[model samples]
Target chain A: MSETTIGGIAGRMPKFIRRADPAVVTAFACIVLLLFLGSLYSRSFLSPEYLLQQLKVASFLGVIATGMMLVILLGQIDLSVPWSVAVGAMMAAAAAAYGPVGAALAIPFGICCGIMIGIVNGIGVAYLRIPSMIVTLATNAVAQGLMVVYTGGFSPQDSATGAMRYLATGFAIPGVPNAVIIWAVIGAAMVFVLTRTGFGRSVYGIGNRERAAYLSGIDTRRVVMIAFAVSGGLSAFGGVLLAGYASKAAQSMGDAYLLPSIAAVVLGGTSILGGRGSYLGTVAGVILITLLQSILSVMQMPEAGRQIIYGVVIVAMLLLYGRAPASR
Target chain B: MKDWRYWLAEQRGTLLALAIFIVMFAIYTANHPAGFTANVVQTASNKGVLLAFVAMAQTLVVITAGIDLSVGMIFTLTNCLASWLVIGTGLETAFGVVAVLGTGLLCGAINGAIVIYGRLQPIVATIATGAVYFGIALLLRPFPGGSVNEDLADALTGRLFGVVPASLVALFAVVLIVWVPFSRSVLGRAAYAAGSSETAAYMSGVPIRRGKFAAYALAGLLAAIGGLFLTFFTYTGDAAYASGNAYTLFSIAAVVLGGVSLFGGKGSAIGAIFGALAFRTIGDLLFVFDFDPLWQPLFQGVILLIAVSLGAFALFRVRNRLEWFL
Candidate 1:
């Protein structure tokens, strides 16, 4: 409580803050700036409704990025995001078309579909030793093809029953959005799993140094597989929410999400290379990216100009945070 | 025989894939005998020429422990530039060709500079540049439309001599050019050495940076060639056409299938050419099979996974056995 003690604390605080991951700080700064800009541009941006709406949009991307973060944390990339989303949506929507029984089928079908893709990605990365980027890229292509072939580019619509519809429109507390709840729950669960679980430690361990991790007797392959499966499942979950939101799945609906998901992950102080990152950082990143896009939309920028800005913003963020000295 | 075995070991992945392609071709011919006729093969070869060039471009960068995702976008830029230039210029047809080629080389140089000098990773760097290149192309002609001389397209598509198409001739020329320098030049050897291990190469005075820069520049040049062929084949330039889509992935597949290690080093241009051919043949076969267009991407994904898996498994097995023997 003394003046000298307070000064000492304050001075040390700046150094501690400076040492904080740049991505986390940037994410925080960006969120504040975006909110400020959004309020200036549109009064509605400050409103609870607008914030909830933004959170709703962020939920889809945030969840997927959480999964993607795991894969990227493992020093691999997955380009199959769009296709994976499409496949998940199509399978779920198609399954749900048959009624509540079908609707119930959608969740497992989507998760299972993702799990399978994750397995392929794991085997490709671990056993086969193919680059995750190329393997995932190819898998994405295959998924796209399957989506088109199976659905003929036309998803059979499932009736959005009250519960399904509640996913997007309903909120836990009045004006507090169901999406926000779902996102918080998922984020909390992931944080626990990432921090407390053996698998989570293995993920960090393997990502940091696979050889060392293996030498330490961790089941590296299994961890990677589980990570990818979780990623695939989360992506599927996003697809399902999207389906519920729209009450229908459309072909290529996942396309817009691919870049945003990666952008979110990158923005979340997690190194793109495996070994060092956190779900908390990912949560911050998701909020930051969502806010950026929402603010841009509120600004009424043209689609092309928005894309140009999107690319610029992402590159800038990467340059600032990407130099973590831990990259391979 | 030992030397032959070593050579075979060096190129086995590509050769195996090529052998599979031949068998696939035979089956296709059996199913559609007319499809394998000389003119058909020539047409397929011609169609594959751009891919072959792009694959070569991809291989160059890959050999340097890098990748060029911007090749397709650069190709778009060149194609658009060709259209823009050819339309306004009073120059001879030869001059037009030179200008197009120049455009591509310049694009490559820019990419090379960014990647090598800027010290950016090839994947992320090319991705950003790919966007810039595509944006430039779109800025040139916003619409999915442009004009190219029909006569030029005809010449590009037509046979050079009675025996071979102009496209085929051009592709062969590329192969010859890439192969000679890659196989014989000290620079090429150094490039490969750098790719295999940058630190070791640097330690041994391999001019690793120079080799990387040159490899990237070569990749850009090859991409430009792909653009030229694309212009001729399509007879038009669309800003959105094949920008950041299948062409980049296709080129990688062709390179990988041809036995070029995705990890960098250990592949041949000859193998890349064949890989291109095989990819095209399979694409054609897919169409012939009446597979839904939706399934195409999935099938390609499966094929790529399978190919990469096989190659990776083989590589691991070989390394393990080598260690055991040693």
Candidate 2:
């Protein structure tokens, strides 16, 4: 009884609530919780039609997050996803106005833009000795300026080009969306690269310890640059599909993807400090976020509420991830 | 040239910017008489004051090798709260101001706690909080509308004596209060040491966690003060406030320009204030010169690139000089 006094009780309490490993547990719990919530609120949510539609929406984000995951795995970030996507879409639409060949050119052109920015980012962080965060932040500003200049604040249209319209708006599996198929293909390709390539190991190695990796004779700068290039090209691809989805490219369409892509990568249990995540995890994370977003939007929560909840959920997930024991 | 390191060590960017400022001012005066009048001076001074405070807030956190993306959010939150709290409380208007500052402190402290205790990286933690803070502001005033009490706004925004704005007095007071604590105290010294090297500082027996928390809290307070004064300029709270966005980028630019290393440590509050003023002056000069609106963003981006390049060049020169000495 004497030992159970206030001071004694306080001294015995643990610093934080003990948590299970977030890698598998948190991901599993979120998926189940989301499914339960969605089913409880709207039975239609579980319907095949609704589920497929959700998959379709998640696919575009999933594809983008796949690239984002690769970049994050290298322990760096790209903030220009939204603008890059917007530019890709607008350029694609504008190219299609020329012909099918022109539309095809937009894809490479967009990828080239991504590669250029990636190279710049890599070089600045590597040789020029600038932080990736600062470099990317500046690039975002530059891209936004370019967008404003090229579009003059107007949304570009594919109204004159049937090819562009068909590319973006056309359906692929009767009721299933084309975006989902493209997303699956990209995700599969990323899995292959991550598992098989020497560059992939170099990326993880650099993220884990740059000095060690450099001393080990890996061209750390080159690997980082390639990571950025891959991220850039993938984001551009997403942008192309986004153009297809919207049927027209808008000035700020790319802005919305920035937070979600990052969130998806982290929530999938990838460490923010880098070198510890997978595309599969990112896919699951993308699905989680996309679903959460749809449910909230459908419930007609105020924009403010949705944003607040989004922030809270993301932070909560990260906290959980931090507390959970590492499985490996 | 071999001694360039010695020159750069003294922060050449600040000196160069000052020279540029003077040249621009001389040109402006040559073009228009009365451009240096009290009214014009006060207007420009007031704008610079707001940016200076925001930059100071940014500088404090960045010194800790962290960033508070939520600073802008805190500014908007304080503004929204001011509009709501000032209108109907029995508390004196002064207390209302205190409450707003307190709110900012609390917001920043929460961010600090999450960053430290939650073990989240500074960037991701703040990004989330930024969203939450902005969301809360929007929730409070779903639409872009709310008025500050007219009397309070007047006293804060109006002139104190002979065309010197009341805002300037408040601004100077902030500088005094913050500068002393930041430069003269043991805690201040510890902060610098900690920022320079976290591991070394920890080994030297500095309270690393406490120092970080204090830096973030101070940043929050400064952001709040900036927001409060901003209310006088706008006379109302708008949910779609652009103040936060302007402060976010401008604060970083100012810090970098003032010779604050982005990797943390080696910066001065006074220098940051000057950097903020320089940035404001550049924008104002363009307005005075009547540059095209369409050209402004492109021009600004180009200017920022040049500024960054110059900063890097100066750093490089300094490094080369150091090698020569060795």
Q: DockQ of all candidates, in order?
A: 0.40, 0.31
Query: lDDT tens digits, residues A1-328, model 2?
Result: 1232111223344532122223544676787799889899989988989888888888878877887888788777887687777767777667767767776676666557766666666665555556666666666666666767777766765532454445445676777577777788888888777766787778777778777787788887778777877777777777777776776778777767878999888888777778776665687788899988999999999889988999999889888764423212
Predicted candidate 1 versus true structure: per-residue lDDT over B196-246, tens digit per residue:
987788778877767777777777788877877777777677776334467
Q: Which residue pairs in model 2 clash with each other? A: A82-A254, A168-A244, B5-B318
Q: Give the TM-score of candidate 1.
A: 0.89
Superposition error at A288 for model 2 (Å) = 1.1
* Location of the lowest summed lDDT over 10 successive residues in candidate 2 chain B: B317-326
Worst lDDT window (10 residues) for model 2 chain A? A1-10
Candidate maximizing TM-score: 1
Alpha-carbon interface RMSD for all candidates, in angstroms: 4.7, 5.5
Q: Point out the worst 10-residue segment of candidate 1 chain B by lDDT.
A: B317-326
* Chain B: TM-scores of all predictions: 0.90, 0.88
Alpha-carbon TM-score of each model against the true structure: 0.89, 0.88
lDDT of 2 by residue, B149-198 (tens): 77777776777777887777877788799866775676676667767897
DockQ top scorer? 1
